[model samples]
Target chain A: MEDSLVLVDIGNTNIHIWEEGKIYDIKNPIAFGEDVFYISVNENKEKEFLKLNPSALNLKNVVNFDTSYIGLGIDRIMACKAVDDGLVVDAGSAVTIDIMQNKVHLGGVIMPGISSIKKAYATISPKLDIEFGELNLKKLPQNTQEAVTFGGIGAVVLMINSLKKDKKVYLTGGDGKFLSRYIDGVYVKDLVFRGMLKTIKEDLREGKK
Target chain B: MEDSLVLVDIGNTNIHIWEEGKIYDIKNPIAFGEDVFYISVNENKEKEFLKLNPSALNLKNVVNFDTSYIGLGIDRIMACKAVDDGLVVDAGSAVTIDIMQNKVHLGGVIMPGISSIKKAYATISPKLDIEFGELNLKKLPQNTQEAVTFGGIGAVVLMINSLKKDKKVYLTGGDGKFLSRYIDGVYVKDLVFRGMLKTIKEDLREGKK
Candidate 1:
């Protein structure tokens, strides 16, 4: 596993690393390791990665789903490709849901991830002094503190319930557990990485021919 | 009716006018007329309205809901106050739902409205060219065109459905017509105005005392 290629999914929020099938969060101290399969929407970070690991395969250029829309986002496409069918819900800085059936990636929705929503209101209205706390969507929110938490998380829970209607929905991301709690979904970590590994295996098979 | 006060609800997307019990959309040329009651979250716009008519009352500063949390938008509280026991879904640049029962304001959820989602993606990825045409929530979106359009509207539809479980929901705002098609809600054209009128009437009653 030490010598294995690191699958990196550079997202709007964080740099997600998949090492030996496990997901690791890496930020600030960017690591340039051995063989790397990299994909990112942020151009500046991608350039920095390229400079550090010249041999790193820019997976963004390599993987394109037949069903993915133009500018659908490389990170999202990779997550969609990981699954054979049904919905792939990636909960990064923003949550993206792409429906893939029989390898064809159908389109999905994008909404602000939980923390992003919280960060938004707090940033705009600093006078409120909304600090972090637990939330219960079942009970009526009493004050501004409860309202912000519920507003951010409740909207997303409702979104997941809407799309996951009577279908097997897969959840992956930092806040996947938080979202999955409200809805019935299978949480699979390192989905983008898993998709990258599949891509590498396919490329190797094609190269041998 | 000529001497009736003009109600202006300056929102994130549009400036809504309620005059003679009708709603008017004013886009380009800003209108100024006799006796205006204005409510807006935007401070600059509030200042401009104040300059236009020094006598105009900005309800954002004056009206405070007994049940609403601090920093809750006046537009939303006003909308909630319009309904006695139901859900108020104000569909503007952002969709906010406030729960009101027995004149007690329960908390609500806020998310990006239909057009905001569309504009956001188009702004981030200009090359996509997501010009609106038609949307079918039942059908799987074929390409980026369908994805962006459907994604924007569909998510909000689902959100409405989630919040509307067993409870009556009312739809308002610029995109209310678009959202109404997918959900079961009574479309109230000028909710902010309706609420504003209610607020002004209450104030006048209190002032008489």
Candidate 2:
């Protein structure tokens, strides 16, 4: 029964669905049965999905975690919930770095993702409209491409390193694998799904669902 | 005679003119007499200014610097020229951090300016359309505003601090004063102009101009 269960995450840009060890990213909500559970940061997409299947459970209703961050996105909360300790980095449209210690959400910072940083550079000037290349943070950049790339990727890498002191790091989101090359971290693509599943299991054990 | 000379910097967004002890920011190029030396990153604006005063000295022709970095901006070069030993940070449309020691240019990195970072956040998601507030780098941000602010400002600060070691930092550009409050540096508004003047003085002494 657990293998058949569908988990959905509605984000700003896409709707991600996971089922039976397979993941799918869709622009629109798919037809799911009553056994589906979902989390959404996009309100309009949530409403659209709910219209298709009103019985689908919203994970936000079932999951609970200790966090002091007010107005934090549910997506971020779910990512943090999966980690009992260490740093959680979700690098997609926006990069969120959350710290979890002893099952408690310490706090996190948000940065523009790789593509967003690229777009920001292009917006600043036509000369900066180039793709970011490999950067060695040990040495300063000597050329424009390296300079911009260092600024975009190096900033994130340096910030994570600054905060990571002796803690394991979990990487997720679209750019996670790419960032993993620069940062010493484990790439967990299904981290959010893991958090949702863990929450459901806890909820079931307590006879709450 | 030095007091009557005008120094203009044509940037992507505005034309900055430094005359005597006063600086002026204008959208359009102003009519200046022959006693004008200017550096420009905007080709269109440079053409417009040259149309009015053909004999006006282009600082790029007179200024010389020792550097291996190719395709480096003239404005950045000018900023670096003013300093013999230190980090030169020109935080305008783009935050350029260049390292110089013993009158030799080492290298640098470029990060988006504060406003560009804000725009990048907004472009990622409308929910992130908020002003960056003062950040405490010691602690992880808890809220969205703080998170975004910390990411924007904290990243630059951390990068600068990491590279600083024992080097003195010089801050210039539009947001130089604001950044000075965070980074231990002196804000010099006329840094680029000073570089240009120094170059012209050297050229005159060598009978090259």
Candidate 3:
């Protein structure tokens, strides 16, 4: 792998760039003079970035994985690829939970992310427009803010915990650290980038053959 | 408790009216000639309904419950009032889950209801604009639609069940019957009205005293 190789993960909201062991989240697509590899969920942003850096390779085209799930997002596939035997949770605009056992994908489920859940409540009623704060999961809420906050965060925590069982759980994405506080899981900020790098290295080895 | 007494539950989306054991969900507020008693979460709708029927009574003004929860929705309180001992799952635009033991309110959490959850997913991205269908909770989903449906519904089901423990669960609101299928709970469609009637009767007895 070239030292200047850049790994980009373009999502619905932001463009995440990984370069030289550093990560940066930019609002809009930016040009890169260096060799770039990307997996994008946003078609428009991908196209915009492609126009600027025409030589950039989309990792989705080169990377292959063993998964039966159809229409699964490439970002999710990449995250799962990084894990050999664990549950991978990609918590961004959407929280996706996928499991991998002995190098085989065992499907997954998707839930709204924390901010999206908060926005959903706000859309339902103006009175419910409040930020989620520190809460005690053992004690039930006694106010609207506590109720909304607990419900929004608690459900996600409980669902993940229930599905976790005895498996090793891997957490990634923007809200990964926030969820790590509640869930007993390893928070890997660069899991997706690691997956992308691994796939690129494997592809290079195949080219030599 | 008069046969002519009309009980109305004004929510964010619709106004549910119960009269003579029949219930009606109307988009616009309607005037009733007979004595009307109501509990409303929507302030504007309540004001509009009051103009249509000048003598209409707001049940929130009269009905009282023993609860430490501040800013608790009156509709949720009414549902809790109907059940002496149980976890009340009021599944509407916002699914409010409250606990009542020996006629005492024990606080609860709020999560997005079925439709709101669906809309939340849709709002996150256009690709997730599919409708939720029947899903098997035991199995992880292998498709986008199934994954979303499972996550959206499964989280709520698990949260309610976890809180329920050995307590009886009472479901009400629009999606009460739908949730009843997954949860081992009794579905009472007019739980709010039952509560309203109960409070009205109690208030009348207190007035005579």
Candidate 4:
């Protein structure tokens, strides 16, 4: 399966190019460029990608869906299309857990991202501007940060436990490894980008069906 | 019918003492002069109130509850007990709307406080600070603050309209006047505190049955 195709993953904060089995980080350009097919799950990014890559005049070959699958984010749609009966948890700007049974979309919950949750207490309450530390699974958190970390991780672990009844849970993104320590499930980082490539392959194979 | 009795209204942030049709602002104190039966909703305040007025320890007349009842706040309970059938909208720290059908309690919705909603955007995104302004009823909101204000008001209007099938809607709290302009329901700003006073009269007659 030797295919010479360039897949551009436009995400919430960053963009990546998928060539062969390697992912190359690319700067999100200010204008649309030729020889680039843009796929993004974020509406804002999709608009920006189109504005920058005016060459993306028609999305006839491009698809947009958020990770939630209610719409596509390059990361989410890719994650959904990439797995088979596996759970993909994107612990990025927002912590989203997407589960696919036989590669069909099953909804998941959206919670405050790790940093977002940490910033919540700090920004909302002046007394809670402390740095959050790693969660100790064996003991209950004593302070506010520890409590937040414990609760945040507990939420993800609970979600995984709920889905683990019949599937394997895969982790990805910045907070995935941190979460993996508390989660009792299989995890694979860097799957968000891979899922994007896989979605492109699927679209190509099915002839844009 | 003229009884020389003083009524006290305890709230989350302030206290109001009603005497001779006039309301006086009173800070919850650890000690108060004679003829004052100190009462408060805050556990800490209640302890101070008892210490300030020794009679409050043996009075068995102070009333309070936490955020668990159908209408927990003194204002909410007072408002609910005031009207026979109507919708009660409390626009305080949080905006909550509940329905009373012939004095029966129906469920309500709890949403972000009006001020909090506008503050949320700024808190989450440091660059998007906005100050609320006077609302124009005839036109749609164009800016962020206006949008949030409209949203906050719209949510209450929607709920009131949805629940006003067979009941009159009543508005209370400091923001009641502001909200009343955006809604078609009746506004009674002091309904909660009034209702609490009425309850006290009834309980005194019934001997705390």
Candidate 5:
């Protein structure tokens, strides 16, 4: 068994795993030698990963960061490391834009996520009552549902445009993939996990520094 | 039906009513009379009121002010007329403090409302989940729930203290009643509706200036 390293990418909706440079779904725990990369929101799943092998405990490397911090989101940090200098957009539970220049983060904006946008519209204006997914790019939505989707996506896209300045753009998160196709930018599905791994490795090395 | 008048008071949470010189629940239609006073959001509820008396639909007066071009909630206009040179604290879903000196609003703050305060804690620190009612005046709460409530109220109280300057304070809204007791001010629940009625009467008599 090699030195077990657990890489956990805790997100609003899901936790991702990257062990030996491979993504593993924690729902089904597997024996990945001494190096076990794991991430989860559900306590039972995390415990399951830990119990994959009793001997795997001693060499376990765990990294945890709370997502509630104002300037820090796991995904944001991950995007920073993934791109040297670019606009990183995470359209997850909320739409956030993190700007980085020369590997240094330049603060970002926190707007209503895709769902929250629809939720707010429906909530604030009862006349606009509709669901979130109903939003899609239409020249002009004939119905309220289509109109709402267009409205919500339009607002977010406009916001993203406001944040974008001559730089490579990267999109991540569940909503990110869906929004990426419509956006003029690069898309990285595993950006958060990859960023976490990079940050962990940096912290570990900086400990020596 | 002696020249029936509709009064509308739109606040953060629910719109209020002042019909025929009496306060009524904005949701209830019976509280209305002839001559429509469609003011702010309550215009949505007025349709129900119209059903009761067919004669009430004689004049539909929609109070339309450019909210975008001008930074004012309809409640502020009412507050301005109801109380001369007073500090109006509309504490509903969110706490807003507007000061009017000589019948003119001097701008205000859009700090997190009590609910938003509770929400911010949950959003920024979801682990400390708690409700507003549970909050107490404590320096340090022994538990997470108390801590959340304490922090939320403390923040509002602190903000009010900073913004307050010896001026007549008037509190409105349902939640405003709860907060009024804690703050150094007077409570005028019917101010919004009363103000709207006053505005309509003035506009009707004077003709839109």
Candidate 6:
């Protein structure tokens, strides 16, 4: 097994395996060298993927950062790698607001993403059915479609504001720019991937020893 | 038919009729006078109820307040009656943030109430299963259950802040008090009912003439 490490992040909708210089979905996975490891929310998927290569490692003993937060997701820890102290606001399929002060995880807020909020309304009150493109995402929303859109924006801004009191907010994920449109924060793409790199470094150092 | 008018506001979940000095749900509709008027989101329910009393009056032109807003909900109009300007935030099964500047409805934001937020996540992503009690609602939520609970709280507070720039905010609906816990706004229990009364007085003045 080579000193290189592989990181697989399993979420609700998709599985992401980081290899080489990019992140890939399961269908588009790029084969990496030996010393592969994975962290996931889906225990079943993790087990299934591990079946293919019994030598693959599971990430253990996280790293220098261990917070009091219970159920600390690896993705959050990845974002934590960016800055020791500051808040990480991930705006993707789900909006996660994590507060990390001096490398100690103080827990955070997790809520539905904008799409999740829109989907929730459509499912419950069918009358609330309306759609707006990304361009219309900004502006004073006039109708139900726009209102829901703007409300989705407002929902994210508020949650971040609630947790981000005087803390420098580090934003990541798909809708990070959309959120940054209002909130003052540093938008860092590929936060989870950064987290993967953080672990790979640890593994690399361990290899040398 | 008596000249004293009845106001019925039929919504997706329930129907409310304003008679005397009180607002009653469909379940406990007081024995109203023959003269009746209704505003509803449900056209089918409107037709069904209209069949019972042909002599009753269905409010046509809404009332004095006519903002240039498209798709203005009766519940919104009801809240509008309370304030000629500022913002009307109804924190019911859904959270609606309507901005009225100089008594003209500019537009608004509609989002999931606490229940809707919870329901949306529950329906779409079953893995997002978290529950928090009312007491847990007031605290800075620690767990996923609490994060979700606080997320719901933050969602409402943010939307309200988006439109309520330096303007007084009027809050109503079931979760008004819950929201007022964080947001500095007046929690009117029956804003829609107050709106009903505002129109009833107009009808009374027109009747004398």
Tell me which residue pairs clash in candidate 2: none
TM-score of chain A of each: 0.81, 0.96, 0.93, 0.77, 0.70, 0.80
Model 1 Cα displacement at B4 (Å)? 4.2
lDDT of 5 by residue, B1-209 (tens): 43466655443345566567777554355544446554444554545545664454221253422212133555555555576676777776545566567665555543334554454445543553446545444332334454335445644554455446678678876667887767788888777766666555565556773
lDDT of 3 by residue, A1-209 (tens): 58888889998888988998899999988888667899999899989999988999888887778888999899998999899999899998899999899879999999998889999999888888888888679888999888987889888888888888889889999999999998889999999999998888886447531
- Give candidate 5 regions above 4 Å deviation: A1-12, A19-31, A38-48, A53-71, A120-127, A131-147, A197-209, B1-27, B31-48, B58-209
List candidate 4 stretches off by more than 4 Å: A1-209, B1-4, B30-39, B57-71, B133-146
Ranking of predictions according to lDDT:
2, 3, 6, 1, 4, 5
Full-model lDDT, candidate 4: 0.56
Off by over 4 Å in 6: A1-4, A27-33, A133-140, A161-168, A177-187, A203-209, B1-5, B27-32, B60-62, B124-127, B133-141, B203-209
Comparing 1 with 5 on lDDT, the higher-scoring candidate is 1
Name the runs in model 1 displaced over 4 angstroms: A1-74, A84-86, A100-107, A114-135, A140-145, A166-168, A177-183, A201-203, A206-209, B1-73, B101-104, B113-133, B166-168, B196-209
Q: In terms of lDDT, which candidate is strongest?
A: 2
DockQ ranking from best candidate downward: 2, 3, 6, 1, 5, 4
Model 4 lDDT tens row, A1-209:
34545556676577766565667676564542354555664467667667666665222244333222333344566666667787777777656666677666655544345666555445533434566567564543334454444434444465455545667778877788878877766566658656655555566445564
Please state the CAPRI-style docking class of candidate 3. high
| Model 6 chain A, TM-score vs. native | 0.80
DockQ of each: 0.28, 0.86, 0.82, 0.04, 0.05, 0.59
Best by DockQ: 2
Candidate 4 C-alpha lDDT tens digits along B1-209: 32445555565666766565676676765444444533355566666656656653211243322222332444555667777677777776556566566566554433334554445445443323556566553443344444434333444454455546677778877677778877777887567556656555565445563
Question: Candidate 1's residue-wise lDDT over A24-50, tens digit each?
Answer: 777632656777788887677777767
Fnat, model 6, is 0.63
Is 4 or 6 the stronger prediction by TM-score? 6
State which docking tier applies to candidate 6.
medium
- What is the C-alpha lDDT profile of model 5 across A34-58, one tens digit per residue? 5544334445555665676445421
RMSD of each: 5.3, 1.5, 2.2, 11.1, 9.9, 3.7
Residue B49 miss distance in model 5 (angstroms):
2.0
Residue A139 error for model 1, in Å? Answer: 3.5
